[model samples]
Structure formats: structure tokens, C-alpha cells
Target: MLRSTGSSALNFGEAQGANTDKDYINKASISLKEFKESRVNLKILSKVDYGNASRRVELLDELEQLIRIIATIIKNKK
Candidate 1:
């Protein structure tokens, strides 16, 4: 969802300023979760039989790529 997609990025920004390793890791985990949720939303949107399919699919692709990039960041945060 929009909330998750945006929240993930927001959480990541907050994590950057985290004062402890645990805080950083926690926030990154939250971000990763949101990213996954966003992916789910986009996937569901893609399956809808009505509405703007082309535009929805394109947006889904973009969101999926964004989630993937965020996932990479989370995985590399050690």
C-alpha cells in the first residue's frame, strides 16, 4: 500500500540516524517489512480485472523494483 511504500523509505531514513546498532537493525527490519507489504499491494493491484491495467502494471513494476532495492540495502546492512 501507499502507507507501506512510503513508510518503508521514511523508516530507512530514520534508521540512518539511529544511535545504536540494534536501533538501526530494527528500523531496517521495519523498512524491509513495509517494502514487502508494498510489493503485495502492487501484486494485488495487478490482478484486478478492471481499472487501468497498463498504468497499474507499470506502477507495480516500479514499486517492485523499489522494494527489491530496499531489500538489497537491508541485506547489506550488517
Candidate 2:
């Protein structure tokens, strides 16, 4: 999950400087999906009593916020 998240983040960085709105939206979409996946994985781990539940919750909150922001950008791009 971490690897996926990191990869998505790198992609997002490239997307941030995209020359076209469509390209930015496309890349941001991928990054957002990856973030959501990470968030869900965090939830599953927490439910299974894996890593620090508190830390997972914190990360979840951050991911949710990021997802919202990215979604807004995609929406506005359209």
C-alpha cells in the first residue's frame, strides 16, 4: 500500500505541471484513486488490530482531505 501510495504521489507531482487540464485531471484521478485505496487499506488494518490504530485514523483523515481536494480540482477542470 505504501509503495502504491508513493508511486501515485510521484505521478501526481508530474500531473501538477501538466500543460493541459485534461492531462492534469487524468493523472490526479489516478492519484486520488490510489489515495482512496490506501485509506481503505488503513481502515482494514485498523480493524484487524494491525499498526497503531490512532495513527491509521490520522492518516485516514489526511487522505480523506486530500481526496476531497483532488476531486474538487477534477470537478472544476470539467
Candidate 3:
């Protein structure tokens, strides 16, 4: 999940350097998908792997916020 999550940002950064609309759209779409998956995996991981619910919730909140920010950027991109 972390790999995908980070790769999404990395790919998107590359897309920003793309020379064509098609390339930008393709990379942005993949980034959006990866971000969503990462958000979901974080939820599952926090529940199934955490020994401390409070810490898990905190981390979940942070990851969710970051995901939302990324999603919003993807959505707003022209």
C-alpha cells in the first residue's frame, strides 16, 4: 500500500512533465486509483494489525486526510 501510495505521487509528478494530454490523463488516473486503494488498505491495516486503538485511529485520520487532499487535487486538475 505504501509503495502504491508513494508511486501514485511519483507517477503524478512525472505526468506533470508529460508532453501530451493523453499521458497526463493516464498517469493521473493511475495515481487516483492507487491513492484510493491505499486509503482502504490503511483502514484494514489499522484494524487488523493495531494493538492500540487510539494510535490506530490517529494514524487512520492522518492517512485519510492525506488521501482526501490527493483526491481533491486529482479531481481539480484540468
Which candidate leads in lDDT? 2
- Clashing pairs in model 2? none
Instruction: Kindly list the per-residue Cα lDDT of model 1 for residues 1-78, writing each as its tens digit.
Output: 779888988999998999987788889889888888887877787777646888778877887787677667767766
Over 4 Å off, model 3: 49-78
Name the top TM-score candidate: 2
Q: Which ten residues in a row are the worst by lDDT in model 3?
A: 69-78
Q: Which runs in model 1 stand beyond 4 Å of their true positions?
A: none
Model 1 error, position 35 (Å): 1.5
Q: What is model 2's C-alpha RMSD? A: 1.0
Q: Can you write out model 2's per-residue Cα lDDT over 23-52, one digit (the tens) per residue?
A: 998998998888888888888888888988
**Local accuracy by lDDT, each model:** 0.81, 0.86, 0.74
Q: Weakest 10 consecutive residues, lDDT, candidate 1?
A: 42-51
Ranking by lDDT: 2, 1, 3
